[model samples]
Target: MAYPQELINEVLDYLDSGHSVREAERRFGVGHESAARWRRLRDGNLRANRPHPVKYPQDTVRLALGLAYGGHGFGLDEVAVMVGVSAPTISNWKRRYVEGGHMDIPEIDLGEIKHLSPDGRARMTDEELEEYIHKLELKAAVLEGTVKVLKAEGIDDLSNDEKAAIVDALPAGFTVTEALPEVGLSSSSYYYCKAKPERPDRYGRARAAIREEFALVGGKRGYRYIRQRLREREDPIVVSGKTVRRLMAEEGCRVSYAKKRRSYSSYAGEISAAPDNLVARDFHAEAPNEKWLTDITQFSIPAGKVYLSPVIDCFDGMPVAWSIGESPNAELANSMLEEACGQLADGEHPVCHSDRGCHYRWPGWIGICAERGIVRSMSRKGCSPDNSACEGFFGRLKNEFFYDRDWEGVTTEDFIGQLEQYMRYYRDERIKESLGWMSPMQYRKSLGLAA
Candidate 1:
């Protein structure tokens, strides 16, 4: 099967994160051979995962150098890494300073002292050079300690411009070269970064629009939804989800996940009135309405708690009918059942299944089943797995919609409307792996099962 570039990229993300190609295929529900072909993934920059080299601030280098010179056991090459300079350059600098009191850097022939004599002080007797180098190294260690303390006290996650500003703000004793190494920037990057104006965020316009949309949705919409909204605007501006996510993260605008509430069950010890488990956990259906699962889940709103009962068809995991009310009563299930049964074609006898709830066992529900010629199947007492298909629908519903928002200040009526709308979206928009990434309605329509 052909997969979209986005889907393939998702698989690549999994692969890049230390997962094997087989694992990526299984995780993203892609084909085995597709993921195994490594060459295809590397062809496009966006399709494959690329390495991001590490970047550091210049002041940080000073801290590393100070530690090494203070007998931290770091070699000259290691010190160079800490300061973002070449190992040879670090060694040369140390030697030149040691041998000539910081003046020998230009005077001495650079190649003559490639071999080290410990400290690099000039013209001093070996004895003097040794004592002076020790003093200097100890001082560097002290400087590193001070730099660490200051960095910890400063703003974390500094922007590039802020880092440059910090370097520019350094005290008189610290030179630009010392600060440059700490930030881990080459002279070119430093100059380019310094020249750019810092007044506006590069993504300022997009960030503003994203923040507005996020606030409108009660800060509950995720990056995908926000990106969709941006694309659907009247004067649609092009943008990517990565930008939205980054902006949201920078602004501390995040959607909080709400835990799902335990579902209410009316499972009593098997009674004579309850029907047999006819479906027997056989959720697979040969055609539409062959197996139907129904269940009720409650939602808490400021106005009051609301209950939703839906009859989901097993063939395509679509909701045939649903009913919502403020009260979790027998009427809610009965109304839902009536609507679902009405959806069946003439002479169709769907096996309507439900948990051993009082609503399903009640005479009202039983009478409807008998009148409509619908076959009734009940789950074993307290065995949710028996009617797992219906439970799965409820789990997905709550996870995607009801469990991720603040219902506070939302009236029972408005909440019910949105809940109903979400169910419609779930059936018509949300894609499923089993359905080949098609929504329930889309899957059914694709097979000419419905218009």
Candidate 2:
């Protein structure tokens, strides 16, 4: 948006009247660049009669062209001010003059005779006209090459802000409209994309809440779990899980952990006699405590391995009792059996099943079972299927709790605490499809089996 000659004169008048350049620019609503150009032109003793930087009328456009070649030491802006137009417009008029050797001033006749000089080249020599034509042709070729290069650069793939920046960085005389087509963007789309995206205040508030809750939960829970827990609050807020996920994506929030695997071993050689495979893979139980499964599984952390021995009632997948220690020994198994015996009321006698590992076959383990009036059952040697129920418990426990965690920072005591917490959460919070979407405690409660 070029200012008019009147404004430029006003700017110049202010400077000549001893006003600062900045003050002159502020008064004329022009920038420092325009003021500096005015100063330079004035210093060069150059003045245009009435040049406008924006547009030129009919006769003015032709007069601008003629003055450019008239050889009165007229620069483009000097020639432009003679009829109130820009240097680029003066240049465009020059392009027409040399290329066509005639003024095809259709839109700019202004009731004037049409010629570079009066009477159609009456005042100009043939050689001078020819030379001007040759120079104009060379300039036109360069301009065309520049435009072609710009078009071939494929700036269309750039982002809108990037394209806008490039357009802004163009030479002073060029407009963004000229560069828009080269970048294969419409003027409307460029302007629209350059504007900032508006988001609602609720959106900001919701994102804050999501971040707070996500951070509060240790950031390990996925979006689904986050959404579920949010709904479970005392003052529940209804929000879609999909919305939660979208907000998570916007915040760059992710579940803190990925799944990894671990392996453990049990002492398998029979230091004592191995029991018969009494349960024989008949894992189904018609009532609580009818059949029980026990196993000693190991968890390895950076601190070292911590062992867990648990008694699970096959009837409900319920962990009746469990013991954890730094070592998986006969004491671990016996302590767990003692807890299980305490879980039984006056009449309940469960057939305890296990793999043929030394922990289960140890004299301490067998003596406890005998004293508790519990039948002892074992898998065949190195055959896991015979104790598939017990093995299945280990698989489920590892898959659900142990496999996906980072235990590198955990000590044996801390790992034991976390393992116990997971067991409690599994019993009271985690749901199973086979249990009709209820946790073990919930299912027992539903069946009137617990106080």
TM-scores for all predictions: 0.57, 0.47
Q: Which residue pairs in candidate 2 have backbone atoms (N, alpha carbon, C) closer than 3 angstroms, thus clashing? A: 51-81, 52-84
Q: Per-residue alpha-carbon lDDT of model 1 for 108-204, expressed as tens digits?
A: 3323332233333455577766765554554464355446545865755555555566566656665667566555546676777887775566777
User: Judged by lDDT against the true structure, how good is candidate 1?
Assistant: 0.72
lDDT of 2 by residue, 130-185 (tens): 75565445434434545554576655345655555555555555566656654445
Best by TM-score: 1
Flag regions of model 1 displaced more than 4 Å: 1-172, 181-184, 195-209, 212-219, 228-244, 251-253, 272-287, 315-317, 370-451
User: For every model in order, what is the number of clashing pairs?
Assistant: 14, 2
Model 1 CA lDDT for position 134 = 59
Instruction: After superposing candidate 2 on the true structure, give the runs of residues whose Cα lies further than 4 Å from its correct spot.
Output: 1-196, 201-210, 239-253, 256-263, 270-287, 301-303, 314-316, 346-353, 370-422, 425-439
- For candidate 1, give the lDDT of residue 371: 98
